[model samples]
Target: MNFRKVRHVVRREYLESVRKRSFLLGLVATPLMMGAMIFLPFVSEGLVSQEEMRVSILDRTGRYGAALIADASPDLILTLAPPGMAEEELDARVAAEVLTGWILIPEDFAETGECTYRSGSITNLAVLESLRTRLGLSLAGAKAQELGLPSEDVESLLRPAEMRTVRVGHAGAREGDFTQVYLRAVMLVMTMFFALIPTGQILMRSVIEEKSNRVIEVLLSSVTPLELMVGKIIGLGAVGLTLLGAWASVGVLLSLRLGTSLPISGGEIGMFVLYFLPGYFFFAALLGSIGSICSAERDAQPFLMPISLTLILPVMMGMAIAQAPDHWVARAFSFFPPLTPSLMLFRYAIKEPPAWEILATWTTLVLATIAMFGVSARVFRVGILMTGKRPTLPEIARWARER
Candidate 1:
């Protein structure tokens, strides 16, 4: 291999990629889009305030309306029914938009305590839970009075118990909330998973276009197939890193402002890069091999679909992974080279796996990446000039095995 020629190819690919319209648009839009996603909720909150919902209360037993009204948020305006006022009159008022909704306490309140809420507006879970809690407190107070229990005892019974979470890891047990752990896992996994998509597409499309246009023939006249493959992978890998770094910086700033600093350490970030670099090279090599074997972009669909689906399986099972990081199935998938980067990273954020698993996952991925690159380069050498038709799997394998 001519080192000078490989260096030239690398420089050309990098400059051509960054100078393209797509790359510039992505470079500018990615950070702005990430900033919007992070801060839009905060900006929109003050602009789009919800109007207070007015509700009428009909207490047939004359017992619970006061309790309900006391617990209502400022957003809920509770109007008690006047004595002798009919339910039909309240229903007419609701229909006339005089009230947003009404809560009806049945006459058999002491026996059943069954309540009906009538509203045209869709039910809000927060509001309904608040009303239920207030009703329960009022009924419990009544029951306590009947049992001659003190108000202090009733208050103690209603108070919720607190549970503090402590995450035990190599760094020792650190107290943190579920929100921090979940956010870290989601952010890390999604960043790695999504950043690979464009790089992989770029490599695949580059290979296909070069082959279809006979540009690979001209390039191979000066450089080996291995040099061409390595140049494209390195150049595109840099592009992916630049985009991801910008997004990560935005995420850190947003998280700091939101008071939920990401729980990932510098060591974790190092591990992320370890997995991502090799993982991207591995998948990109596989896609490049497919591109070299096919005559056109359309010819690659059947080959690409399975690889795309396999890559996406981890994300689809993300909730399961988070809930049960140590589960056998998650542990099994974490070892798979294609799924390892996202799945293992997810598992690490949720719950650190055993040291042996980490070592083994990386070992397998590194070996797989090297072996796949060799196979891709071999197939690429043979298939780059085969323009008439796509090759069969056996033919591709034979090409890969040949000297």
Candidate 2:
């Protein structure tokens, strides 16, 4: 109820957090790390030494081995291995640093056309795909030229061609691109990953300290339990915002340095911050509630495990949705409250969600945040004074539902 007190507390919390060495280091380091994460890959791709990628092929197809090499890019190195060489020998070659990897075209490979790979190391997928595609094109071109017969027809067969790809949804609706949906999912999930754990730790530490030092008793005198809870949530919530803002500023600077465009707009950033604040407030309240219900840090374990579990779900969902953004299963995670912010962010980043879905998702989230606060406040009120024993679920429920 005291604006002055809230402001005072908020100022103190912000100042203290900003003064921490970790915060300072983050402010300085985040930009550089972000820059590297953005710039290095592109830089590597463009400016990397034009050393060829040598892939050895043991061919079963009498006519196809040379065709694959001819079709490859100038940067590719295609070597032919003699027949009867064991894969172990090839691996030894790689181990001895004489070769990178090899592919085997078995005796039946000419008929079935399947390829086998032997390697001491996992190769870059892009490189593998490129080799396979170029080889296929070269062999196809060879066959076409052979069929064309005359020199003039062979020239025609060599002409460059273009192709366009389109994917249709279930209704045959032209889903031009659902990548926005994908980007949104990726961003949201990543944001949560970077946001939740540290923020939750802040909440837990705040509660544990208060419980240990008995400061909650004094604070409860001046402000009601609800006020104290809200203040802590707001205070720590601001810290999370500050950390995210610093990280984002560094990201922007790095992107600029790297000449990489950030997919998020000012409007999107504002929306994300908007969503993130409420989401953290919600989770902070839950974590603080758990922390309050415990008598000591040791007692916080059983209570803390569920928060850990809740955190894990979204990461699990992120892995699943990365492959198929439009899958109903992915959509279901987007609506799940614990995972919603991350999943929704990813969805929005990849593609703008229909207005109704966005509205409905947050509407549910806000309601949940409100309920969590209520439960948190009760546990904080009852468990603040009690010590020596962690409150059981029934006790926490009773305290929360107390008249």
Candidate 3:
């Protein structure tokens, strides 16, 4: 608890991290990757992309169906079916792979216009819909002209009505960020994916490096158990923060330059910093405490995996959370401390949840962080010095209670 010791540990952790190669590489690489992801949409869009499709037509109305093909597009190559060719024949061609797809003009073509598409290989659902819609409209327009009605009027009647919706909270919200909300949810998931594994790994390796060489003996001789425990937490935390900041900055800059600048506010960034700090510190302390309790790296798997999986669940359900932040499952986890800060922070940042909910989420996590650190500090102090014995949860609790 000494200010001098805490300060000394913080400084030592920071220096050790600055000297590591992993930290340096992360700082440089994160921004570039982010930039690339951001600009990729702009760079890759509308670039001669086609499905490599060739289409054919069996026209019962002869003129109407052939006209539909000619106007289809540069992408669609419509070949004329020979006279007396049957519907079965066109179906056979599709099955034979002679055509990518075909639009069948039924024999009852003049009386009713129900054109169907036939393909052996699956048509891209989107492309199929486009063909059906465009071709249908083209046929309908030609029929309307024969009946002395404007093709435009018929099309207008069939068009979907445009709508405008309003949300009650957070001014300046946009429709585009619906995708972004889902995307940020995705990013939140991926960030945790990238983060928890490596961070836990670093914790494991740090423990192994110290344990394998008996580095603990040298440090234990000079510092108290509390100082060593706190030192490792602060040190690894600095490394995590440095890497996170680098990755974030990279992603942000790249998005701004190359990708869509998803309408993120200062509050969202602050929530990320605030929530990530607790979520990560909570896990880091948990992991570091585990590392301290174990004599070997392999020993950590028993404890670490359960905790790791619990945190990973929210990230896995990220899309579901984004779609419905107020869903019972999402809301329930928002209150659970281990999942709260990351999952809720992602939800809150994207949608800007109710003020009371945001306040509760932050407050609960902050309290949990304090409580965890206290217990971890005690377990670390008692266990770090004790060798060949792993402490249980009851032992950590009893040690904290006695301390």
Q: Which candidate gets the maximum TM-score versus the true structure?
A: 1
What digit string (tens of lDDT, one per residue) describes model 1 on residues 216-331?
88888888888888888888888888778877787799789999856577657977898898899999898888878888888887777777666657657877877777899998
Rank list by lDDT: 1, 3, 2
Full ranking by TM-score: 1, 3, 2
Tell how far residue 263 is off in model 3, in angstroms: 6.1
lDDT of 3 by residue, 205-308 (tens): 67656766787788777777777767767777777776777677766887789868644555666777777777777887777777777887777777767787
Output the number of the lDDT-best candidate: 1
* Cα misplacement distance, residue 353 of candidate 3 (Å): 1.1
Candidate 2 accuracy as lDDT? 0.68
lDDT of 2 by residue, 328-386 (tens): 77677667777667667765554456778878888888888888887788888888788
Where is model 2 more than 4 Å wrong at Cα? Answer: 25-53, 57-62, 71-75, 80-97, 101-124, 149-188, 256-260, 302-312
Q: In candidate 2, residue 15 scores what lDDT?
A: 74
Backbone collisions counted per model? 0, 14, 6
What lDDT would each prediction earn against the true structure?
0.79, 0.68, 0.70
Q: Residue 326's C-alpha lDDT in candidate 3?
A: 82
lDDT of 1 at 317: 84
